[model samples]
Target: MTFTQLLRKENDDIFQAIFNHPFVDGIGKGNVPDKAIAHYIKADFEYLNAFMRIYGTAISKSAKREDIQFFNEQIRFVLNSEIHPHHNFCDHIGVGYEELQGYALPPTADHYMKHMMYHAHMGGLGETISALLPCPWTYWEIGQELMTKYEPSADHPFYQWISFYADESTGEITEEMRNRLDNIAEEASVEEQKHIKEAFRKSCQLELSFWEMAYTCEKWPGKEKVNS
Candidate 1:
């Protein structure tokens, strides 16, 4: 089996939890609260900023032009294409997309971004890719599942959000990422392979937490205080 397939199979339980999460269920039914949707839009907009930085780190470590271009292209996709869903959500909720840029990363998002950045800065290409893979890969899976279950019409409140991730383009890009991770794994040291597996699993777990975070509109505990 391909490394990516193996990762998915091993983590099937986590994927199932994500699939069954109430947040995802709400999106499928077009009934999620506006507050929850707004929270997600703000958190994810900040999260994408860190996602692009991880890709930038990968590009800096790349030796081959093809690898560099691959990372570069995905960065462009996140900036230009993946962001459309955020804009749509903002528009639906009557919030300005630009305002979301000033929001702080919620607790779960902050930890997830730190996890990704650590791997990008401290690990090899294989490890970095493994760490980054779950975000897009699982989104593609979630998108496919939502589309199959709901077949949302154009007038559905979340139709644009759902259709954006379910698109052929999203699947194609996700496939490209998986293939690249598999190729990188082929030459990875045995120890590195272990790290790769751990990274992939941890990232998958974090993806599930992200859904819960949005569902609850998670935030840092307690208010900040100024010294007297």
Candidate 2:
């Protein structure tokens, strides 16, 4: 089987678990409000920013010397070319530097995010890979499904957002994560099967609600700023 096929097969159980989730459920053809979906995506960007920071840290430290150089080069490009330009999803939803600095969400949520960063920084890439598996895959599944089922209207803000993270470029990140996953599976002496599943589920739930909350806030005037 090809890498994509193999990945799908091995990760089938985990994907099936998410297949029943509300976030993925709503992405199907339905009467869902576009604003609601957009909000959730915006909230997700906040989480993404936090997540990127953590993953960026791990990628920095855990990479081999050559990989570290490559990692730095990639990051420099991401920061300079993508984020610095403010041309990605964050800008689409008004999540500028000011907003991100003052954005409020659960402290516990921050902790959930921080754990991955800490793992990467301390335990190296393997532990970090285990810590960081759930969100992107879940988001990719949702994006792929939504794009397949519903055409985004011209007014849809999330079209750009979804496409930005769901493109082939994201494959670069996935490849890195999978490489780390291989090392993790090989190295870990005692892995917790239940926690791995639970962490993914909890992260998905958090992600779904993140979208739900953002949609709720976006529908209200003078409420563009989201706080916990």
In the range 1-228, model 1's lDDT, one tens digit per residue, is 998899989999998899899988888998887788888988898898899999999999899999899999998998888878888788888888887675888889999999998988889988899889999888888888999999999998889988998988888877888998899888888899999999999999999999899889998889954455
> How well does model 2 score by local distance difference test?
0.52
lDDT of 2 by residue, 19-68 (tens): 55554454443434544444444444465566657657765665377556
lDDT comparing candidate 1 with the true structure = 0.89
lDDT of 1 at 207: 95
Model 2: worst 10 consecutive residues (lDDT sum): 81-90
Worst 10 residues of 1 by lDDT: 219-228
Off by over 4 Å in 1: 224-228
Pick the TM-score winner.
1
The Cα local distance difference test for each model comes to 0.89, 0.52
